[model samples]
Target: MSNQLVAEMGVVFIEDSEHHFFNARLAVNGKPFTSLLTPRRIRDFLERNNIVYRCHKGKKQVNEEKQMEINRAVARHLGCLKRPFQDGSPDPEHQYNMDESHFVIDLDDGNPLDFVGAQSVKYRSIVSDRSSGHNNVRAAKGGSNARILCPMLIFKNKKSSYPILNLPDTVYGVYYRSSPSAFINGRLMTEWLQEPRCWGHAWPFTAARTLWMENASGHCESEVEDTARELRTTVRLFPANATEKVQPADRFPIQRIKEHWRRLAERRNIEAIRKGDWKTGSASSGKLANPGKQLFLNLASECIKLENEEKDHNSVDWAKKSMIQ
Candidate 1:
C-alpha cells in the first residue's frame, strides 16, 4: 500500500506539483493519505530510487500573476521599460536600496561534516524560549558608481537576561540600534535618513536623492514620505509582491551577508567549546550566550572588509586599463 501511495505521489509531483508539497491534496488508493510524512522516510525512498534532492535550488512563493504585476509596476516607476536610460538617468551615487534580513544565533544552515554515506548528521546549539534576535539590515548601493552606504543593524533592546555590555556607537561602517521589535517603522526610518552615519555622508554627492524600498507598512507610511521629501529625498516604493525581482539588495548582497554571518557564528560556537566557556552539563544546558550587538558588528565588519577588497581589486584593474590606453 505504501509503495502504491509513493508511486501516486511521484505522479502527482511530476504532473501537477504545487510549489509546496504540503499544500498538495495527497492521497493513496483514492483515500486521503493523511499520515505525517517524516523526512527520514522521504530520504529513504529517494535514496532507494537514486533520486538526489538538490539543496541549492530555492523554492519561490506561489504568486506568479502577482509577481508579474509587480514587475510591470517597478519598471514603470523606474522609467525603464518604455523609456531609455539616456533620457533621464538618475545619478548613481544618489540611488539607494534598503531591505531587512533576520538572523538566528542558534540556527545553523544544517550543513554537517559527516563521513561519506552516513545516514544522517546532527549538530546542536543553545536553544532559548525567547525569540531569536532580529537583524534589520539595510544595504544601500548606488548605480554605476561602486559606492555602498553603511549597512544598518537593529536588534531587540538588551534585557538583563541577555546582557550586551559596553556597546560601541558605531562599528566599521555599520550603525546599531536597539528597539522593542527590532523592526524599521516610520519613526525609525525618519531617524535613519537623518542620521550622519547613513544618508548624511551622501549629502555632498547630490541635493536630491532617490531610495528604492519594498512596500512594507513602515516604508509606505505617509509620514515617512513627508519626512523624506522634507529631507530632499524621494522614496520610491517597489510594487507589491515584486521585491524579489526588483530590489537590488535582495538580489545578492543580503544573502552574502547572511551566509557570512552564519559562518562567523559557527566559528564563535566552536571557539567557545574549545575554551570550555560552554559547559555541557550546566543548568543552562550548555547554550552559548545570546548573540548581542557586538557579534553583529563583527559580521558587518567582515562583510565590509570583503566588499572593500573586491572594490579595490576592480579599481586596480580599471587603473591598469586606463594606463594602457
Candidate 2:
C-alpha cells in the first residue's frame, strides 16, 4: 500500500507502492519538482529542531510556585491540627486532608471511525448495544454524558487512631463558564475551607489534630487564607511539585471513581436507548421518548449529585468507607 503525505500546505500526495517516500513539496507553487523531497528529511528535521516537550499534552505548569506556597500553608495548618491529637497531645480537634479529581467521559452515541494499526491490527467500530430491543436505536449526538468529580478529605480520631473519609455531597462540580473564575466560586471556596473545621459532624476525634490540603487552584485563594487565620486553624502545605506523590486523592480513589463513573455512563446510555425509539412505527399508543437527550440529562445530574455529595462530605464527615472493596 502507498503512503499518503499531507504537505505543509495540506496538499496530499499519494506515493506509489514501490516508493517508500511520499514526495513532499516545500512550497505550494513555483517549480514543484525542484522542491520535491523524501519524508525522511522532514521527519529528521522535526525531531532535531523541536525543543521543550511538555507532559500532559502541552499543558503549561503555571502558578506552580504559588501552588507550592499554598502547599506550605496546608502543611503548617496540618501541624497545628495534629498537635492536640498527638499521643501527648495539645488539641484534640480540627484536622483533615482535601483534594480534587479529574475524569474523562466516553459515550457510545456516536461511533468513531475505524483505524488500522501497525502489523494490520485494525480497530473495529463500536456498535450500539441492542439488549433493550428495537425501541432503543437512536442517532448519536456528539457530547459527553457525565463527570464524577470528588473532593475527598480524611479525618481522624486521636483516641482510637481510627480514620474516616469526609466526602463532598456531589461527585462533580460544574463550571457555568469556561473561565477559571466561574468554577472557583464563593460557595466552593467556603466548602474547601470548612473541610477541616470538623463542623457539625459526629465522628471520633484523636486527642491531637491537624488539617492538610494540596495547593489546588480552587483552594489556594486569599480569602480562604484570611479565613483560616481568623479561625485559628493551621493550614499545612506540601512540598513544591510534590502533590502527585503526596495527596491521597491523587494517589487513590480518584482513579477508581472515574472508572466506575465511565462504566455507569455507558450502561445508562444503553438502557436509555432501549427505552426510547419513537421513530419506529409500532403501537400508536406507545411511543418512545428521546433517549439520547435523556441520557445526557441523567448523566449530568449524576455528575452534579456526586460532586455535591463529595463536597458536602469533605466539610462534614470524618471518614468514608473504601470503594475498592
lDDT of 1 by residue, 220-242 (tens): 88888887888788887777776
- The TM-score of predicted model 2 comes to 0.38
Give candidates' CA RMSD values in order: 14.8, 19.2
Q: After superposing candidate 2 on the true structure, give the runs of residues whose Cα lies further than 4 Å from its correct spot.
A: 1-93, 107-182, 185-187, 194-209, 275-325
Candidate 1's C-alpha runs over 4 A off are 1-60, 63-84, 109-123, 126-130, 143-145, 158-166, 200-206, 279-286, 311-325
Q: Which lDDT value does model 2 have at 300? A: 41
- At residue 9, what lDDT does model 2 achieve? 20
Clashes of 2: 59
| Per-residue alpha-carbon lDDT of candidate 2 for residues 152-243, written as tens digits (9 for 90 to 100) | 22121222111212322332322111112223333345544454322323223322334456555655677777666655555665554566
